[model samples]
Target: MKVVETVSGIRETLANMRTAPGKRLKVGFVPTMGYLHEGHQSLLSKAKAECDIVVLSIFVNPLQFGPNEDFDKYPRDSERDLRLAEQSGCDVVFMPSVQEMYPNPIRTSVSVKGVTERLCGASRPGHFDGVAAVVLKLFHIVQPDKAYFGLKDAQQVAVISQMVSDLNVPVDIVPCPILREADGLAMSSRNVYLSAEERREALVLSKALGMAERLAQEEGLTFEALRNKIEGEIRSTPLADIDYIEVLSYPELEPVDPSMETVSRTSDMIVALAVKFGKTRLIDNVILHRK
Candidate 1:
């Protein structure tokens, strides 16, 4: 129920949390840009169940946005988000200003190689560097014992996991399941920008991924065949413009070669897709793990 705007204030509060006499509380952090939804609520719900104190930080990090990206236009509603956070069982909400986080004009950034070379990383360029930098800053600021992220942004999750592992960040990175609409569209803040018609078309992203998953379960379907089928499904929708339809190894995110025997029915894989419906770009994914 407490809201802290300044980094120092939150740090001081968190310090008290650790040193407070009697019970030592376990902190869980969920870092996000403001506009709250069912997906974000799902993360907080999980965090609340697992940790004693849940810290939700709502800062639309400029560091993670490209020059021409939607940082300025990104949807934000802190009042509503704050209410939702409290309802979702958040103990504190950290809402910091851009200037406060970057008082001196940022000159440093974090990056993880290999994992950042494909999918959203390749398309956005320097996007993961911004994400890594901002996340590290938040992780330091919140000082949570565990940080929660959703599986919808699988690439982002992979990048963060890699950064945490490589740098030995002392926190558990917990990824929750992707929460979808009743119609199967993955929830996103940008979903607000979609026109009514575009919203309908956007379901193709999930539908295609569903097809990919089904194909993966069938015998004799190569990686290429599954990818091609998924791509075809997206292209069939008049409003959907393909950004990227990729089938890659999970966590590692390396593209799966069709000729490789490792890509058979029993292989673990991720089907990721990004599509543009008019000016709104949306991303979704499905993880395949068959025994």
Candidate 2:
């Protein structure tokens, strides 16, 4: 129920908690923007269960949004978000202002090299750099033993994992399953941007991934054939424009060779996609393992 707004305040609070009595603090952290949903709650709930204390940070990082992206218009409801966090068993909410986070100009940033150049990175330009910078900042600020992220942002997950490994950050990165609506659309704060008709069209992203999964499992299609089928479905939709439909190695995120026979034998493949519905961009993915 406690809300700390400054980085120093959060660090001080955690330091105080560390020395309190006989309790050994096992901190679980979930970093997110201020719009609470089932997806965000899922991570918080899992964190609460696994750790003695759960900390959730709700800061809409400006660094992560592109010049044309919706950093300003991104949905935010801190009051509701706090209630949801409390209900989900969070111990503290770290809600820092932009000034508190970046009082001075930022000079440094983190990037994951090769994986940062593919898929979403190819389209968004400095997107992954922004993500890496902000996430590293959060990891340092919270310094949780374990941190949770939704698998819905598979590329983000992949990028974070790379950053953690390469930089040797002392935190466990855990990726939870994608939380979805009743009709199967993945839950997102930006989902509010969808007009009724565009909302219906948006489901195509998940449907396309579903088709790719089926082809991979039942039809025994090659990765090339599977990708083509998925792309063809997106192209058929009038309202959906494809950003990228990639089947890549899970952790490293390198593209899988369509001609390689070992593609079917690999257990860690990710079918990830990003699509534009009107002015809004949404992402979704499915992880596949050969059975």
Candidate 3:
């Protein structure tokens, strides 16, 4: 596996990939803020199985983080990240510094309007703008045939997909399902900052997701009822600081009104939640298609 820390270096690396002996290789890209876990590995694994070469970029994007967010405290371990990248069948790893990514003051920013206005975007203003900007930059840099993203950040997936479609970026956006731990916490890079007690309490997000599925699908509860049940469960523990417990239409991310639908079942809906355990903020969601 090759590690290129500079833009010129990574571009030079990929220039060779396209001109290789056999037919042009199809590249799959996975962009991550490093702290390699099963969640990230899963994207690389899927990309490896499907594409000729998998390129993984590990850069903690300052753009995607809010002013008050944990950008500095966000985790990093290059030695371990590289080892895991190689294990996950990654061929090239792009590990760039913030200065390298944004050499000059970046005046250009990318934003997806409707999708960015709600959920995570509403709370953390301009968060998706940073995400869209960086992802687009990587897309141009790698120019992969396809890119892989985890559905754990369904809002993010929705935003990027919208950006790709609206901008007519030629790469396919492949969103994989959420990968969780044995007891069901949605794996995140920030999971490292969590205390042992907070780690145990973190399962509430997953449990709430489970409850979300059962209540909405089987019981066909109203949006208010579904929200109440999930909120009640997460609030059962004092440590789970509730940020938002939203039941809304998927991809579009507009809130579903109980008065309009009677029951929460709609076309394709998402049960999304964001909660803080100590200093670590965790988000999880379940996507359901109409039956």
User: What are the lDDT scores of the predictions, listed in order?
Assistant: 0.89, 0.88, 0.90
Residue 131 lDDT in model 2? 88
Q: Which residue ranges in model 3 land beyond 4 Å of their true spot?
A: 264-266
TM-score of 2: 0.96
Question: How well is each residue in 159-238 modelled by candidate 2, as lDDT tens digits?
Answer: 89989998899999999999999988999999999999999998888888887777776544678878888999999989
lDDT score of residue 33 within candidate 3: 91
TM per prediction: 0.97, 0.96, 0.97
For residues 125-216, could you state the per-residue lDDT of candidate 1 as single tens digits?
99999999999999998889999999999999999999999999999999999999999999999999999999998988888888777777
Give the clashing residue pairs of candidate 1, or none: none
Q: Candidate 1, residue 12: CA error in Å?
A: 1.1
- Taking the tens digit of each residue's C-alpha lDDT, what string does model 3 give over 146-182? 9999999999999999999999999999999999989
In candidate 2, stretches whose alpha carbon ends up further than 4 angstroms from where it belongs are 260-263
Q: Judge candidate 1 at residue 7 and give its lDDT.
A: 92
Better of 1 and 2 by TM-score: 1
Number of clashing residue pairs, candidate 3: 0
Off by over 4 Å in 1: 261-266
Error of 3 at 168 (Å): 0.6
